[model samples]
Target: MQIQEKIAVVGGGSWATALVKILSENGAEVNWWLRSPEDVAHLQQYAHNPRYLSGVRFDLDYVKPSTDLAETVAKADWVILAVPAAFVQQALTPLAQDAFKGKTLVSAVKGMIPVQNILITDYLGEQYGVPAEHQCVIAGPCHAEEVALEKQSYLTIGSHDIVRAEQFCRLLRNRYVKANPLDDIDGVEYCAVLKNIIALACGIAHGLNYGDNFQAVMVSNAMTEIEDFLHAIMPLPRNLTGSAYLGDLLVTAYSQFSRNRTFGNMIGRGYTVKSAQFEMNMVAEGYYAVQSIYELNKRLQVDMPITTAVYHILYERFSPALEIDILKDKFK
Candidate 1:
């Protein structure tokens, strides 16, 4: 594992920590950025993140923890954005527009711009002038928790440049992890966003005590809903049954580790949105994603019953029980 790639991983969350662990363990130099000074100090001293995946220790010689955004991005050949979508703008505000000019940007975020409703790659292209070929997205049936536990996991690197994607994939693959490249960047990214919404819907159903049989119908109907929406927006030919699309959807919907499902279950079990968010203390990307997708659909006019049902319950203050019951009639 004698690699010479210098990577910059932005954000201090579990996913960011996990990426740093993988890359550094594989012998790449990682310039890690964290918002909090205390977390940086903790990682530098303890060789582990105090707040996230603390059990996994890092080799400090390969990991350089820092708080300076510009310096972190300046030294890396590749920059991975692992921050939540809601704070993406704020997180990168300190850097100049041309900061990412020659660097390969990888988005590990499974969300869209909240109100603008654009993908991360789109936003990077528009705001920073990064081209489609220079950008990549990390899609998963893979979760950070599993990565920390050394459980077998699979990841899809979606990019317009398949060669570049494959090159990047080599940096990720190891015994417990398998990385593959996909040419359908837009399709993969959009599926990542939509699946979170589906997970929330599934969580809500589970919270309502709807059994596996009912959820099976919901997931099946959701696959159709996703197909229609992707066609309406991107109009690309893609296999939704791939690991990046349906596998990711199924995992997020059913995994006990899904924060989105936990959030939805709380909402279904009589907790308000605010209360659930407060209690969990983590960002469930689906909560923000549902709103963006819902608002975007107003113009696209796609028939997304699951997304619509989620938006109604989360945004419009519709009763969860009422929404789920109504959603039941729409599903086959």
Candidate 2:
């Protein structure tokens, strides 16, 4: 736990590559894991990830590449999960064999399973038995491109263990990546998933050429809905108003870097839901989260109006423009 003696960056994705860059810049002896042997060879040889975060070169000397999961886990004092939302449960299942060795489990995933309706955090807990006490959830407005470019960005690290939390913070804090220690692990996790749903809505509005007034109203109502939703599960005081919530929502909804925004924007441009998803290629967390949240509403009965609208647009084949009009009517 002291400065992440040997770190494993799991999954061969843009976020994982960006985090490996962070670790390398911070002088971490990190083993970066790619699912493909070819990717491993490229990173080990050329220091590049062509499949995911292409065009961003890494410092291969500081970081080693491994296609073997067990080999990477064996060398890790901490393992960072960077897989897509749908793959998270499968990713954690193999780790149940004590492969992680009770090391710090840090997740960068922000989506849920559409079929099971499970949060990535809870799924990891159940499958890998990574107790709530040892798990860390990192979420923020940081983009992989920005981190790859070494642009200034910060993210939140919330763990049940304050000591591990602090050490992880110090380990990842760098000139380019700033890690902040926080106490609300659950709030951070839920906010990370839920905010993407709102971002999709914002992008849809923008794609439809709805002016800033419509975007303003939708996001404002969304913030209130998210705060209420997070509060009902447990007690979340002022933390929801911070970066993990509004800051993330604002940027993801407005920024062109967001795949969720792009996904929604295409939907607004009159693309079918499947077409939108097919074009994006990347897993849009909000697309999955909306379905999960809609399923959750059956029991929780919390009014996530924005989420409901997005769900209708994505799943029910409801017209995106009509749904926006409906959300406007309901929230207005």
Q: Each model's TM-score?
A: 0.99, 0.94
Candidate no. 2 TM-score:
0.94
Model 1 misplaced stretches (Cα beyond 4 Å): none
Q: Write one digit per residue (lDDT tens) for candidate 1, span 1-332.
A: 96889999999999999999899999999999999999999988999999999999999999999999999999999999999999999999999999998999999999998888899999999999999999999999988999999999999999999999999999999889999999999999999999999999999989999999998899999999999999999998888999999999999999998999989999889899999999999999999999999999999999999999999999999999999999888978
- The per-candidate count of clashes, in order, stands at 0, 0
Task: Find the 10 residues in a row with the least total lDDT in model 2.
Answer: 92-101
Question: On residues 253-299, what C-alpha lDDT tens digit does candidate 2 reach at each position?
Answer: 88778889899999999998788778777888888888888888778
Note each model's CA RMSD in angstroms: 0.6, 2.0
- CA error at residue 295 for candidate 2, angstroms: 0.5
lDDT of each: 0.94, 0.81
